[model samples]
Target: MTQNKLEKYARLLVKTGINIQKGQTLVINSPIETAEFARMIAEHAYDVGAREVVMRWSDELSTKMKYLHADDEVFDEFPDWAKEFSLSYSRKGAAFLSISASDPELMKDVDPNRMARQQKVASSALKEYRERMMSNKNTWCIASVPTAAWAKKVFPDVSEDEAVERLWDAIFKAIRVDKENPVAAWEEHKRNLKNSMEFLNNHNLKSLQFRNDLGTDLEVELPEGYLFVGGSEFTPKDSEFPETEFIANMPTEEVFSMPKKTGVNGIVYSSKPLNYRGTLIDQFSLTFKNGEVVDYSAEIGYESLKSLIETDEGSRYLGEVALVPYDSPISKSGVLFYNTLYDENASCHLAIGKAYPVCIKGGENMTSEELEQHGVNESITHVDFMFGTKDLQITGVTHDGEEIVIFKDGNFAY
Candidate 1:
């Protein structure tokens, strides 16, 4: 990829992804491996009127080293400074932008339970930060970067440099970074997604039944007043950042909303491998009863899968259900990026734990207990696993018991 094209891509992210506003502080959470690109983004953020740009550097190797060497006490510790630092950023109205690009097998041998425990502690420390995000009170965006290790995972047959370029090109297309007018294209794309979400919300869908030959025949319930969000967080009612809209995830495709915590049933299989706690969980099927994952099996990462379901009481139930067509750009590319940011956008999926407050009517203002009473889950984690395929179908049942096929053969039906 040429430097000019790369810079243009960076500019697209700064201008259209999070839409950095004048005098706003833009925080970039990225790995040290992508320092150069991160710096480029920082420059572009400033050029777009950002008051300050903060670069938070992290690396998988360091984290893996910690998991391999840190003592048990590290798993339970939640430093006050760590909590305050993030809180300070949110408190200051900083616009956050995180980068994801790590080798899928980075934590191939790490202990899943240990990682879960450590993450739980960290999640607890930043619970308020999460609250701000879920409420859409703070703006944030997540975009992918191309790293040698990540490129190697996506393209095993090519030289590392070639793999990187190929992956970059694919990502550019997926995010519309290569559009003749990227900003305008994204505006149109976001409008289309919003229109889709509007249709779902207006349908008053009570439940969704999914079926596939992979033994997936699950039914998920959606509470009244549920909302679907995708592409951007700018609902008609949102008055935040009116000048520049908020895009939560770059390359976002799925129109997602909260599923009633106790309203899911049946068995469903995962369509793609999920990289969790540094472990790759693939070929998994979960059985649900009353919205809780009662049983699960995986070709690999059984322990990791267990850690996820058993993380907390809320973890056992469904939190978010998302719909993405089988023929989405990311899906048709025929590459498994092995990263959730890309993979989840390629297919239909669901998240366990921590429902977004934006997904329910007045959810953004409700307390955890209040949300729970409405069947919206509350937990410290949210993990998404894909399950869309060529033969997958989803049917929506209205409150009046009228049944309508929402998805047929993995494509949305009008």
Candidate 2:
């Protein structure tokens, strides 16, 4: 892409995505390989009159080596400045760009248990950050860059350059860069998702049923007064941030949520494989009863799944519940993007870890003691996996005994 074109896309993110205000801070976390695009973004953000632009770069190999060779104390101690910096971002309200394109197997050689612990620490940091954001109302965004490692994951046999180009094309299309005006395109796109939210809100369903060729027969209850939020919210960053501009779904193959901290039941299967800690869990299935995972099966990576479930008391419970239709932009691409960032957006799925407070009414300030009293589960992890496809069906049951067909064969049925 030309510099001008790159700038145009960056401007799209700054103006429409992050809605960069004249004096707001913009943070770009990019890989070293994508410095070119990152610089373009920084310049574009400045052009939109941003007060400051910060950049962070990470090397996958170095990160892996540190975990493999560093002293155990290193994992226990985060730099005070780093923690302070993260807290400051929430306090001041900055827009963040987290570019993830590394291979899922970047740390495959490391010990699995050690890797899980490292993940626990990272997740704990994020949990604190999320809490701060909710309390302070900060806006942030996460996107990916196509790098050599990421390309290898998509097309193992292809040259890195070829993979990068192909992945870039996919991203451009997914974000709707092919449109005449991508910014205008997203504006219109978000409005459509908002309509779906309205539809769900009006349906007033109590339980959702999903039936698909994958042999899925699952029913999940809806929490009372669950608000449907498409893209956007009132936050301290420019209210116009593209991150906020999105409906909760993206390239969205699914519209989903965590089962009522106490209402998930029945059986469901993963339509696609899940990459957990550099291992693949293929042909996975889980049986739930009254919001708890009772029985589960996987053709691969059972140990990782077990480790995840055993991580905390609430790990066995569901965290995120989502809806992904078959006709999502990623699904329409007709490519099995193995990465969860894209794959999860390509199918309806649920998570097995920490549930989002925002997803439930009166969840944010609710303490763990209070939540447990209410029979809602909480955890430090919130991993999502896909299970719904175009061949699947979802039925919504309302409090009034109305069974509404929300999805048929993977597309929204009005």
Query: Distance (Å) between predicted and true CA of 390, model 1?
Result: 0.9
lDDT of 1 by residue, 1-414 (tens): 778778978998898887888998888999998999999999999987999998888988989998889997888898898788788988777888999888888898888877889878998889899888778777888899899998998899999999999999999889887878888988888888888898888889999999998889999999878998888775233424543568888888889999998899999999999988667999999999988889999998888888998998888988899999998889999989999999999999999888898899988878888888999988899999999998889999999999988898889987
**What's each prediction's TM-score?**
0.97, 0.90
lDDT of 2 by residue, 76-139 (tens): 5556677677777756767776665667666556666776777677667666776645422555
RMSD of 2: 2.9
Question: On a 0 to 1 TM-score scale, where does candidate 1 land against the true structure?
Answer: 0.97
Question: Any runs in candidate 1 off by more than 4 Å, and if so which?
Answer: 235-244
Candidate 1 global lDDT: 0.88
Residue 212 CA displacement from its true place in model 2, Å? 2.1
Question: Number of the top candidate by lDDT?
Answer: 1
